[model samples]
Target: MFANPMILFIQVMNSLSLAMNLFIIAAGLTLIFGVLRIVNFAHGAFYMVGAYVALSILRVTGDSNLGFLLGVLGAGALMGAMAFVVERGLLSRLYDKEHMLQLLFTFALVLVIKDLVKMIWGSGQYSIGAPPFLRGAVNLGISPYPKYALFLCVMGPIIAVAIWFFMERTRWGRILRAAREDRVMLNALGTDVKLVYSGVFVTGAALAAMGGALAAPRSAVDPGMDSLVIIDAFIIVIIGGLGSLLGSFVGALILGFLTVMGSIYLKEWVIVASYVMMVVILLVRPWGLFGKADEERH
Candidate 1:
């Protein structure tokens, strides 16, 4: 199957697109885990909700780049605001509680958000056509490839760089990193740890939502979509190493390539192939490819 150059090129491009999408979502998951020490099970729910919200926005604005941009921004802002509420009203109370409680609370949030989505959007699958400028295909010497997929290929890295710059260059980003190192010490310096935590959670949620909104134009928006992406995001995070942004990017790329290739070669066993790879990698390096062993403390 790899003998065909055109087929290989298209699959490679597709994998790149997939890797970037997974990175965006998994990056948020890792960031939340890194700072708040909470495994947000509802991250996927936010992703799903973003897609639905984007779809609604697109319906109102029609087929234009501005419409897509609004959809993505609106979805992110909405999810971020919702995250603020969740962090303040519920998650705030659980900080001193057992890890189990945090897990259960977030898991419960998954169900609540899913049901709420069902109520609002029903169970139907919806899709948005690519913006006019992105609707066609690009000639890649071998054959034509989707312009939107190419756009996604570029978008992933742009987002990653932006995130890196934000974390590395900004004062709030420095505070966030400091909080990750030691919240108690950060608080002692008169920084509002609570506010920082809330901000981190909201930002992470917004990134997940933005990822979903961006993906909506490429795939169908439907019920249970959150479940699917969440599983993939978890796999990426685990493989990349919890709390490591670089790990998330590398892990996403590995999984994306494996999944795309496995679908072509292993057929129905593609998922098993991914897990097998994970197991093998874990056996070799328990903390993941770029993850540090000491970062596991909660």
Candidate 2:
């Protein structure tokens, strides 16, 4: 009934947990788009890879917690390496080309990665158990909360904070920001813009992969996951304003809360509600909630 505040609270937490994962994926997409000016449709493929890697390692290692950590780290490293190759080997060649061409190349990558995953793992759903240490539940006033959900809530913010610190406080971060703003100026100043681009792509891929790996225990890894995730993530990136980390966080919260509320009330229209919100936001603010139009031409 309306009197149960606990139910509402539990739902809020659930939405936030989902938003955290979305934020991770959107953050990477925003950064890559902001700097390299490519949408990297394959980002979701990297996310799927994370889940698959986590599932495989967990089964092989037979250690839940270690598997979790290794899954994240291993997926990040492998995806980063893959992205590095794509950026340095392929994208670098298309730097002077039209945006549409670059996007089409990434689009082709999406299909390749999807089939590769299916070929290697088959088109089946897979999952791993939560670590024994986090196998219990904590009762909230509204409903019992899974320990795994609580752990995710905590880790998500920590990651957000860490990324903020790296982007705002480090020298490398400064160089990257400058590259985003003025690639020609950066290159003229003796910076290797190609290296900068590669670095950004790899970092973004790693973040997406880590998010996927972290989520594997909570959800099954399925073949359709890549494209399924890209749609939602793209909405988040667009609503948050391209290239803004803080925007990504806020957009994630908005979409997360909306989905949770809508699912509870209008379960059939949950997906529709997300896109509807995106439409409303775009109609009102084309530049996005936090993103400004880029002045630099590629």
Candidate 3:
């Protein structure tokens, strides 16, 4: 099997796409957790909504490259605004409350979002077709696969770089990073803490939503997706080291490769194998592969 270089390369490409999607969701999650100190369980809901939004837009706009881009951006903006409302209207008040209460509130949000999606889209599985340009495979002299996946693989790192640049080079990113380090001091120094929190939530939610949109063509959108995506996301977040963007990327790649390889080699026990890998990672490096302890230290 190893002799089939094309097979190996395609599998590698598949793993990369999966990793990219995971990174998109986890990047937002890490940022939010890094700054807000709240584990927003509603993130999965945001992702689900994104898939639905993209599906709807694509259905209306027909299959085209422009439609896909519009669908992704539209999903991002819509979810970002929704997160803004949720953060400001509901989660904002719970900031000082206990962790249980905070989790409960987000948990309720998960249910609410689920029902809302069902009501709007109905409880049915749906998928989007790849745009005309992305329909076929880029032949690697072996088995051909979808070109869209390759596009996703490229776009993923471009996005990651953009996010890193924003966080490290821009003033807003600096302010956000500063807020993550010490909200109390930032507030004391006259920075508007509430606004910063809202911005972070919106940014994170937007990325999660876009991830859903990007994954829509490859995966079906349905009711159980919220729970399903969240579980994978949780693993990615934990493995990457909580609140570390770079960690999220690394963690996603590891899980992506493990899942792809396991499915190919251990089809009967793929799920079990994946979790076992996670267990080993956690046992050896509880803080995650590139994650440092005390992430909030300024």
Candidate 4:
């Protein structure tokens, strides 16, 4: 399989594209966990909803390139608004409750959203095509790669840099980092930590939806899609270290290669390989590869 240079190069490109796609989804997850301390099981459901929303928009706009842009933006906006309301009215009430209650709450959200999705879009699967501008292959000297795949490869870093700039360079970013360290102290300093939490939740949820929208062109839009992607998102975050954006990025790359290459080499045994790698990483560093020695949020 590795003998052909052209084939090997294309496979590497595939892995990079996959990694970026996964990173987009997992980034929000790690952010929410890092700040709110909520292991949001409903995140996957949010992603599914985004794809469906995009699908509906595409139906209305009839596949125009402009329509695709609208679909992605609309999906993010709608999901973010819904998340803001949910955060304020529901999730906020349970922030001080037991962790199990929070877990159960998010799990319940998953069930509710899944049912609503089925009711609205039916239980069938739908596929979305890339926009006209992003269709066809681009010549990359050694190999011609799909335009959409290359788009994903570029998007991942652009997003990472944007988020990093927000987190490290902005006042709000410092506030979030402060909240991660000691939210109570930040609150006592008159920071209105509740608003911060709500904002984080909304932004995180929006990112999940946008990731879903961006990903819809490459994958199926189905009711059960969340179940699969969420597992991958968790693995990426866990392997890279929960709540660390850098960790999620690195972790995504690791899993991307493992998944792409492992399928070629290990085939039927590929699924087990992921968990085995996770277990080994845990044994060596429970906090994850980029997780801090003192990663616990106050």
Candidate 5:
């Protein structure tokens, strides 16, 4: 499998594209976990909903560049709005509760959102075509590769840089970091912790939705798609360190490479390969590659 140069190049390109999509989804989950300390099982539902919403928008508007743009943005905005309501109405009430209760609440949300999606979109598969400009293959040294896949390769790094700048350079991003470190202290300083939490949750949800919208053109949008993506997101989060953005990027890339390569060279061991990598990584670094060990609380 490794002998053919063109084949090897295509596999690398495929891995990079997959990694970017995983990074986008996992980034949001990590952010939510880092700040809110809540394991949001419903996050995958948000992704599924985003895809459906974007597909619906595209269908109505026709598959033009404008339609594609609107569909993705609209999906993100709608999911964000839904997240705002959920945070205010449900999650806000659970901040002081036991972790188990919080987990259960989020798990319940998964079912609710799934049912809502079923009611709206029904139990069927859907998909959208790539934009006209991104429809064909481009020659890249070794061979021609799908233009959309190449676009994804470029898009991922652009998003990663944007996220890094937001977290390190923006005032709101600084506040979020501060809130994650010490919510009580931030609150005592007159920052509205509740509002911050809501904002963070919405932002995270919006990112997941945007990822879903981007993926819609490439894959089938189906009822169980949420569970599949969410499982991968969880694996990425665990491997990358629960709350580290850099970790998410690294983890996604590693897993993406392993998964794609395994499928080609070790077909039967593809799934096992990823888990083995995760296990080995965890054993070597219990706190994840970039994750810090939590300080003890008295």
Candidate 6:
């Protein structure tokens, strides 16, 4: 009956690991919405690009721990650079356009990126093994735990704290918040709203890419992987409340636990469970668990 302490410990670790990885992805989605007010459907594409790009780098660098590190950083940087170009060259032009047009633009971007990825990487599944150092298990009191999973658990909290500090304590963070509230006024104040928007988009894309790179050790990198992940990311953001980072963190944890537990119990019905949770949350608190009402946001 899933009662063993060791079993519970393992499940906890699995859940935490999944939650952390998912949080990494969902945080970027939420951040983009927080400032730019754009619901980027292409975030998942950015994530997939990161994994593929990292895979390319690791192939060249011999897949050492250093190579993995380089791949992760490089993926982030490359995606960031690409994002800057897109933001400045294309997306910025649509800033004043209608939301429907924005949606079409991003949706088109998704198709373009997907096709481009297939052209470059072909249609094949590839796996990225964890660094040799992280391939083993570590003793965690009652049961042995995977080093990679443990690393993710620790990393999740560290990233959450770092982002929290950046958003709450830093000067640019304040500008970002102010820009989110009133981009026109911020621009009037000589803050270079376009530059700030570009930075936000770049940071968001880089985060997605880095998240993909970090996750490659555990998942298959393949075409169309972004499709399912976009669903997960959107669910997290919607339930967490769009534009709310704290909400995304908590929501990711919730989805992570539900996903791990449901896979054990419900099997194929696990997806149904996620939908149910989303539905109930929507019914009870449309604003999300940690999200504010739209009126409050205004």
| Best lDDT among the predictions, by candidate number | 4
lDDT of all predictions: 0.90, 0.84, 0.87, 0.93, 0.90, 0.92
Give Cα distance to truth, residue 294, candidate 5, Å: 0.7
lDDT tens digits, residues 65-148, model 2?
A: 776778779889988998898888888998889989988998998899889999999997887777877888987655889988
For each of the candidates, give the backbone clash count. Answer: 0, 1, 0, 0, 0, 0
Residue 257 lDDT in candidate 1: 93
Clash pairs of candidate 6? Answer: none
Candidate 3 residue-wise lDDT at 10: 82
Candidate 5 lDDT over 1-298, as tens digits, reads 5788888899999999999988988888999988999988888998998899999999899989999999989999999999999999989999999999999998999999999999999999988889888999999977999999888888888888888898889998899989989999999999999999999899899989989999888899999999999988988888898888999999999888988987888899897887887788889987778777776221
lDDT of 3 at 121: 94
Q: Of the pair 2 and 3, which is ahead by lDDT?
A: 3
Model 2 regions more than 4 Å off: 140-143, 294-298
Per-residue lDDT of model 6, residues 7-86, tens digit only: 98899889999999999999999999999999999999999999999999999998699999999999999999999998
lDDT of 4 by residue, 128-202 (tens): 899999999999999899999999999999999999999999999999999988898999999999999999999
Model 2's TM-score against the true structure: 0.94
Each prediction's RMSD over C-alphas, in Å, is 1.7, 1.9, 1.7, 1.2, 1.4, 1.2
| Model 5 misplacement above 4 A | 296-298
Q: Local error of candidate 3 at 182, Å?
A: 0.6
The better-scoring model by TM-score among 2 and 4 is: 4
Any idea how many clashes model 4 has?
0
